[model samples]
Target: MIYVITIAIYLIGLVIIGFFKAKQIKTQSDFSVAGRALTPWVLVGTMLATWMGTGSILGNAGKTYQTGMAGLWLPLGSVLGIIILTQIAGKVRSYNKFTVPEIIGERYGQVARLLSVIALVLAYMVIVSYQYNAGGAVLHTIFTDDSGVSAISVETGTIIAAVFIILYTMLAGLLSVVYTDVANGIIILISFMIAIPIFLVEAGGFDGMQIAFSEMGKPEHMRFFGVYSFIDIINFCLPGFLLIMGDANMYQRFFC
Candidate 1:
């Protein structure tokens, strides 16, 4: 019940923020771009929250659980991509356009813009769907009884998540998203700060983990490659690299 309450409180705080921000949304530009007045720190927070989604917290974490240290390679591609993006971030921001397709349209043509829009729509739809699933999974985990039955079904949780996300986005557009993202970024940072040490201590540190893996007959789990071939690493990495490079969310933040 405490866990559920905490989740509810967090969501209620976001709703309150959205409500307040909506009052300031008098025009399309204000709603879409926060009137182009976001502080550097808010931009940092938004970027962190945008990039660190279900893929980072659940997908990559699960891969790491299975593959051990080699799972780090999965995110290394995105890290490298972000580094490359930094070189062009200033240029992207200077374009001062509303969206990635706008910049592409100016550079290429209407045909290219239409193609980019189609691609972005497809990609974002998939991202949002999985995000809803992730939200549902979170709720299921939180509400499941010791007997393994959940108070609410994953489908119901998914519907709730989808409704909240759609309504929140519609309320104040990017203004609400950026503000809530700042809060989320702080929460995530604080969670890592508190959890990592506790986790390491409970696991008895790297040497303990190594010994445990050896005893479990899974010593390969401690290795850098972790039973995966070089080709497998490349394959795991390339898609994330390419996706991050072309991610519309990150580019839209840059535009803001």
Candidate 2:
């Protein structure tokens, strides 16, 4: 009940913010770049929320729970990609394009732009599907019956999430998204800060975790490489590294 109420309030807040921002968005530039007047902190907040999605909170965390430190390889790719992006970030922003394909169209051709659009559409579909799945899982968990059966079906929850996202996006474009992301980034950071110490304490600290893993006959979980091979690490890293390098969302943020 608490979870449902909290989520409901959050959703309501987002709607209100979207409507408020919509009034300010009178032009294409205002919608796309928030009038090019966002603060550095706002950009930082949006970037953080943009990068850390369900893939980080749910997928990577689940991997770490099951296979331990090996999961670090997944994010390492993104971290390295970000490091490289910093070098060209200034140039990207200076280009003053609304989208990645727009920039590609200028330098390359209509053919490259079309190809990029197709590729990005396919990639974003996959990304959005997982986000919907994660949102559904959260709703299902929170809306369970006394017997532990979910009151809300995953499909219903997924549709709800999809509607909310679509409505939010259509409301005010990047203006609302950046503000919402700033709030989300702060919440996520605070959540981690509060949860980590409690998690360590509940698990009886690092030594206790080591002992527990040892007793479970999976002491390798504590090792730097966990149970992953060199090939496994490379496989885990490459996709994220490559994705972040060409991520249209990141480029859009830069354009903003």
Candidate 3:
């Protein structure tokens, strides 16, 4: 019931935001770049929030649970991406391109633009699908019961979530998405800060945590390096590194 109430509150908040934003919609540029009036803080907040979506939270948690501190490498890779982005921030803003394809076309050619569009569309679709799956898993865990709506099948729940995303995104476009991301980032950070300590205390402090970890047969899980080799870390970080070098989303945020 608490979980349902929480979700309801979030949905209501999103609806209210979308409702007001609808009135301000006018053009494609307005939809795509939010009129290019976003402040730096807003840009940073949205960038952090969008990057730290379902994949970052759930996927990272699962990775950390199984592979220990090696999971931190993912966030580390993201941080590197941000740092590299900073170097090109001025260039991106100067170019003032809305989409990746536009930037690629300007720099390279028509072929580059077309190829970029194809790759971006395919990658984004896959990303959205994964996020839908993650949300469904959360809902299923929260609302499970022997009966009553059958606790919502993962596929059904995912479809519903995806529909909401589509509607909200389609309504106000980047303006709505960026502002919501900023707000969500704040909420997520606060939630983690509060939850982690409470959870640690309940689990009985550092000493108790050690004992439990030993029982689970993974005492060194908290170490920074853990058991991963240098080669393993490089392999894990490579995709993120390459993506960051030429990510359209990062460039958009830079320009915005």
Residue 200, candidate 3: alpha-carbon lDDT: 84
Could you give the candidate ranking by TM-score, starting with the highest? Answer: 1, 2, 3
lDDT of 3 by residue, 1-256 (tens): 7889998788767766776787788977778888888988888888888788886788778888887656788666667887887887888788877887898898899998899899999987887789888877777777887555557788887887777777778889888888888889999889999999998899797778778888998888766675788888887787777766766677777767
- Candidate 3 regions with alpha-carbon error over 4 angstroms: 146-150
* Candidate 2: tens digits of C-alpha lDDT, residues 43-114: 999999998889888888998988865666779889999999989888998988788889899999999999
The collision pairs in model 3 are none
**What lDDT does each candidate get?**
0.89, 0.87, 0.80
Between candidates 1 and 3, the one scoring higher on TM-score is: 1
Q: Which stretches of candidate 2 lie over 4 Å from their true place?
A: none
Ranking by lDDT: 1, 2, 3
Better of 1 and 2 by lDDT: 1
The TM-score between candidate 1 and the true structure equals 0.97
Give the number of the best model, judged by lDDT: 1
Evaluation by TM-score, superior candidate among 2 and 3? 2
Of the pair 1 and 3, which is ahead by lDDT? Answer: 1
Which residue pairs come into collision in candidate 1? none
Estimate the overall C-alpha local distance difference test score of candidate 3: 0.80
